[model samples]
Target: MIEIDALTKVYGQAQAPAVDEVSLRVPAGSVFGFLGPNGAGKTTTIKMLAGLLTPTSGEVRLGGFDVARQRPAAMAQFGAVLEGSRNVYWSLSAWQNLMYFGRLKGLRKARVAERARDLLTGLGLWDRRDDKVGGFSRGMQQKVAIAAALIADPPIVLLDEPTLGLDVEATRTVKNWITEQSRELGTTVLLTTHQLDVAQELCDRVAVMRRGRLVADLPTRELLAGFRERDRYEIRVEGTVPPGFEAVTREGVTTISVRVSDPGEVYEVVARLRAHGAVLESLTQVQPDLEDVFLALVNEPSHAA
Candidate 1:
């Protein structure tokens, strides 16, 4: 539902582009995670997709409409909740905010009212629908903003740090809501966040950026599986670690992690630990998660160079 083609963005007089030839396609009804550290241009790419910023080169299309050439039609295909900004009117009640945004999208009052009720109720904000958003907690306010964004039932949603500062409960609620919208309503989600665990759980596919370039893009499970194939193990012991072993001590337990290219190396490590008079507590294969894979990808020797 979203297509970006060789998208490049260079700020005034800057030698390097903020986003360089970045291209991606997000399938309809799928959750695609856009990940990068600070200044990696994820936000810049998002701004271009939202038509908030003009790209120095290339193009963005939403639901097949070119964002730059068909601004209104492209905009009608998506809704965005950008980070570090208030997405809703603080003085407006939650219901009012939804109605206003829905109407702005050309939705009829009766249709918007029905959607508002359903969205507010689903977001657990129905009770406070009539209350001013300024008086609500940050989580509540965020929920209201999200409701407003979806009030028009746009097919695509651009969410930057949707669960950033929420408490655990609120985070879970938002996460579940995203999943439901994608699974049930066939909504396409383009999510950008620092929360790797959340991305691991929700994103069908993930793309990582570094220095304004696309570094890695793959299905979430495939990415994790590639990292998992590495033979790494974590060994915990009750005594001193031998020389040449990197160990961390915590609560009287010495932990050592090592990667082996050969199965024989496992026994060699165990024998070395035994020779050091260390009482073995446990030995387990290390399973890499999204964070582990992400760090490895972003911190590659080439990236560092």
Candidate 2:
């Protein structure tokens, strides 16, 4: 539902572009994660996609409509929750705020009320439907902001750090809602999150960005495979060690450390140990995780260069 071609955004007075020649495509029913560190042009890219900021160069198409040339048509097909959750008026109750935006989106009074009630109930905000948003906590305000975005039932949802300040329980609620919307309603979601674990759990595919450039784009499985490390096999042996193995003396006992490429290697190492008549005490493998990959990519001097 979304296509970006060579999207570049350069802020005036800045030495370089905030978003540099980035191109991406988000399909109709996929959860696409946009990842980057702070000031890495993630928010700038989202703003350009939302038509809130015109790109210095390139094109952004939303559901067959160019965001810059045909803003009304492009925007009509999408809903968004930007950087902050301050869209609703403080004086109005949650229901009223949704009702107001619903009408503005061209929904009938009855439909607006119905959607407002359903979303509020779905988000567990129905109990405080009559409460002023200003009196609510940050989490509550975020829920209201989400409800406002969903009132129109747009096909594409753009969430920029949806769970930024929410607690664990609240974050889970929002995550569940996002999953349901994409799975049940077939809505296309463009999610931007700093939490790699969240993205790994929720996104079908993730694209890592650094320094305004696309560094890695892969399925979660494939991405995980890239960071998967060889297993470590530790064997404790008695007496003099075999010729090929190096042993370290700890408490007057010799312990050997070997790097096993896979399970088959572990089996071979154990068999060799038996042949040499060395006492084997323990063996274990440590596998790399997503955090390792994230750190490697972000820290690589080549990526920054």
Candidate 3:
């Protein structure tokens, strides 16, 4: 649904580009995550693809329409909530905001009312649909903004920090809604957020950026699995342990840590410990998670921005 090739953005006469020769592809009906720290060019890349900013070089295509060359066609292919509640009007009610944006997106007038009704009801804002947006809470306004973005029922959704500051319930609501978009509705999603857990949950594939460069891109599972320290293990034992797996005694219990080169070595180590009179209490393999993977990748000296 989305394709970017050699995309770059540079300030006038700057030594380094804000987005440097970045390229990526997002398959139809898939959720793609964009992750990076401050000044890593995530926003710049999104803006370029959304046609909010002109790229210095290269191309951005959405749903097969060249974003720069075919502006209207590209515009019609996606809906966006890049700035959260700011996308909606303060004076407009939820229903009114949807109608206005529906018109702006060139959606048919008849479809606008139908889509607005469905979106408002789906987002739990039907009861408050008539109330002015300025009177709503941030979370409510955000829901309304998201509703407006989907009012046209575009094929692709570009969301930046879709669930940034909402409370637990509200965040869950948005997360489920994004999931529903790809599953039931077959809509493609391009998501960017600082929340690693959210990305881990919703993204099918993710790309990491550093200093405007695309550093990593892979399926969510593969990316996390790649960061796992497979051979690391923690063992609780009594008596004695093998030479390399030296036991440390604390609180009348002996604990040892070992990092083997291969998985089969774990069994060999266990056999050696048993032969050496070690009495094992527990053996636990260290598990890796998204937070650990994200921190390790982002903090890696070469990937740091």
In order of appearance, the predictions have TM-scores of 0.92, 0.84, 0.87
* Candidate 2 collision pairs: none
Per-residue lDDT of candidate 3, residues 113-174 (tens digit): 99999999999999999999999988888899889889888999998998988899999999
Tens-digit per-residue lDDT, 1-305, candidate 1:
99999999999999999999998989999999999989989999999999999999999999999999999999899998889999999999998899999999999999999999999999999999999999999999999989988988999999999999999999999999999999999999999999999999999999999889998889998778877855888999998988888789999999998889997799999998898899999998888888988888888846421
| Candidate closer to the true structure by lDDT (higher is better), 1 or 2 | 1
* Clash totals, every prediction: 0, 0, 0
Residue 236 in candidate 3 has what lDDT?
86
Better of 2 and 3 by TM-score: 3
Show model 3 residue runs off by greater than 4 Å.
235-257, 262-282, 301-305
Quick one: best TM-score, which candidate?
1
Judged by TM-score relative to the true structure, which candidate is superior, 1 or 3?
A: 1
Quick one: best lDDT, which candidate?
A: 1
Ten consecutive residues with minimal summed lDDT in candidate 2? 283-292
- lDDT string for model 2 (100-209, tens) is 99998889999999999999999999999999999998888888998998899988999888898999988999999999999999999999988878888899877878
Tell me the whole-model lDDT of each prediction, alpha carbons only. 0.92, 0.85, 0.89
